[model samples]
Target chain A: MPEPKALPFSARDATCPFDPAAELYELQEREGLPRVPVPSPIMGEFEAVELTRYTDAKDAMSDPRLQMGFVFDPEQPRTMMNQPGNLLNYNGADHRRLRRMLTSAFTVKRIRGLLPKIEEIVDSRLDALEAAGPGADIVHEFSTPIPTLVICELLGVPYEDRESFQRRAKIGLDVNTTREEQIANLAEMDAYMGRLVAEHRRSPGDNLLGSVVRDFGDQLTEDELTGIGNMLLVAGHETTASMLSSGVALLLQNPDQLAVVRDDPEAVGDAVEELLRYCSPAIALPREAAEDMVVNGQWIEKGERVVTSLLVANRRIPGAEGDLDVLDVRRTPAPHVTFGYGPHQCLGQQLARAELRVALPALFKRFPTLALGVPEDEVDYRTTALVFAVNKLPVTW
Target chain B: MTLKVEVDEQRCVSAGHCVTSAPDVFDQRDDDGVVHLLDGAPPERRHEQVREAALLCPAAAILLRERDGSA
Candidate 1:
């Protein structure tokens, strides 16, 4: 690499849990796009030009020239990341074909229709939290279960199958798991989904996966259905669970901010957006450049990788109002890259928004005096994982 | 004022941002959730929302052009 910048991509400083490493912001503030060596658990360490500016990150994310699913060889040792139906492993036409089949289930109107069910799920979780009483971990009691239950219902996994689904949900989120362990866990996941998809094929249920099988069965193959089932099940629940947990922690730390979210019904939508921006839960996975491209007047070479730091790029959005360090619950929602941009933008964003919009405010309303069960300093944040999350959030209200 | 609005269904990932931002001007298919432009030339009153929809679109699939430039 020509530049002296080497970055530990997803490491979060305990002292400042909300931000990426300080060097990342500096690279953004510096003049030209810097080709920094970034270490990846999946791809090992490689030189990737950082897209830290808001415009550059947004534009490049959607740019056809910058693609995903090409970085790692799928069959070299096929893992869940690129299994046949996983959206993360496909680009262009192939990506569109797979994604469009699932889009109807996640449309904004579809999510709107789902509000009552989501509310029911949130309320049930709240009841569980109250039953657990004081000294309950929100991760287990509130945040985690809400999304998982909702996703399970959406995917139409039989009640019996969810235990298996939930058990392996965190496998990909652990930073220290060995690659062999990941492959084994993924293999287990593949087989499980395979069986589920097989059942869907025989007699499609009313759930999302069942509906996909019901509606588009002939167009998709067995492996593709299995990949879609697993990816949707995993990505759908895991991302929201982390965001919910982290947003609760962020709000609990800032009582004034939490007050706004709790008291104002109108503020919930905007509050969730701010949470998505301030927390920026998921990191943008690297994309391989198929050809040389210039973003923000800087050129990236063909075959080089590009990493857009969502945490940094989100706060640095040029016209976004208010201070970056402060989490404003009432801030007008900005065009943050939290759900990403372009073709591969998150498929379940509307669904995630609906979950957060309902869950966060409901948690506070139900437990008005919610407080951290452990001391603030004792809270654990899993920064090294693909999704930044609070591992365990013990709460008492 | 006439505000022209168009949606590239091919580029749209059906994030429903346009529908959320400007429901009058944009809608999604019942099947695949692809976007459809409800108003090719939205009236003056709906111009601001139409612009917001275009801005918020994740796919950048919504295209907008202003005609009758004078306000």
Candidate 2:
């Protein structure tokens, strides 16, 4: 394959420490906002396009020509990037079909029904925390477990197997993990789901896995089920965990904000929005252009992979009228691209909301004295990985 | 009073703040960590607490409004 034309700049020039957002902001300053050719060690070698501006990114998300599962370089081998067709990568009819089928699981009404169960899990985890004492790693002790258990239950996976699967899922998302290790973790998840799918086929349960097997047993292939399971499993747990752990950690650091939340737990919804904008866990979503396109006035060729930095877009950018970054929960009709935009919007958004709705307020009320165990600078943020997250958020109440 | 409550599930990252604020009204199921509203209307004594719950929502999924006619 031939090398693509040189980008106007290097990521290092625009890089923000711990957050690549600085580079995006730099581009925004240059009036070269969208399609800025974000240089990625991964995308650079592959000659893919990069997207930044909100409008272009959303448009590419809904575009039909851009293929999700299509492999540009056959020699690159089928790895995590080449996984079977799913909503995030797929376009047109297949995308519509899969989206429709999974839509019900994400609706607010459907998610609202799961609240009681969500509370039970959180309480149970808090009970364990009491046993462990005041100082605990909220990420592992509380944040990680709650969502892992929840998604496991949703997928019908035995709760007992959650720790191991969670380990595998965590490894799969680790960008620093050796390519082989990453691929191995993904394969391990796929194999595990394969067995579950087979078992469910023989004697299906009432879980999401069994439902998929029953409803689209013929249409949804085993790998497809596994793919969807992987999506649900990883996405379902990881991002939500980041939000909880990070949200608490942030509140602990910002006492005034913490007091605001403590005074009105219902403000959790607004606080979460500000947090999502403030700390967008899913920092960037990679998209590829199927044909020649111009975004934010920059020309982007076909077959280039682009990533929109939602973290940056949510913080600083001119919106319809005012600045988009103001962190005011009272800002009425505030819309965020944190869950993403257009066709690829997060399928598990409602479920994510319900979890926060129950968890955030409960956490504060349970431990009114809850505050960070360490300084804000000391908190371990997930720096190298694709997802902007923290490794461990230690807190004490 | 209208006893208005708004839920922005989108803002909810499933942090479980509401459940702690008002256990009787908010909860986290064993099944999923997502927050749900068990009772549409919270108790009067807990109203202030529920207001706190709404504020703490990491996803900002919960909002409260006081109805003009009743409390």
Going through the candidates in order, their DockQ values are: 0.87, 0.04
Docking class of 1: high
| Cα error of candidate 1 at position A123, Å | 1.0
DockQ for candidate 1, please give it: 0.87
lDDT of 1 by residue, B4-57 (tens): 777788899998888988888888998999998888988788888888888888
Candidate 2 on B22-63: residue-level lDDT in tens? 777676544334566777776677787787677545445677
Candidate 1 runs further than 4 Å off: A1-7, A71-75, B68-71
In model 2, where do residues sit more than 4 Å from their true spots? A1-20, A33-44, A69-77, A317-330, B1-71
- Worst-scoring 10-residue span by lDDT in model 2 chain A: A5-14
Quote the positional error of residue A250 for candidate 2 in Å: 0.9
> Which docking band does candidate 2 fall into?
incorrect
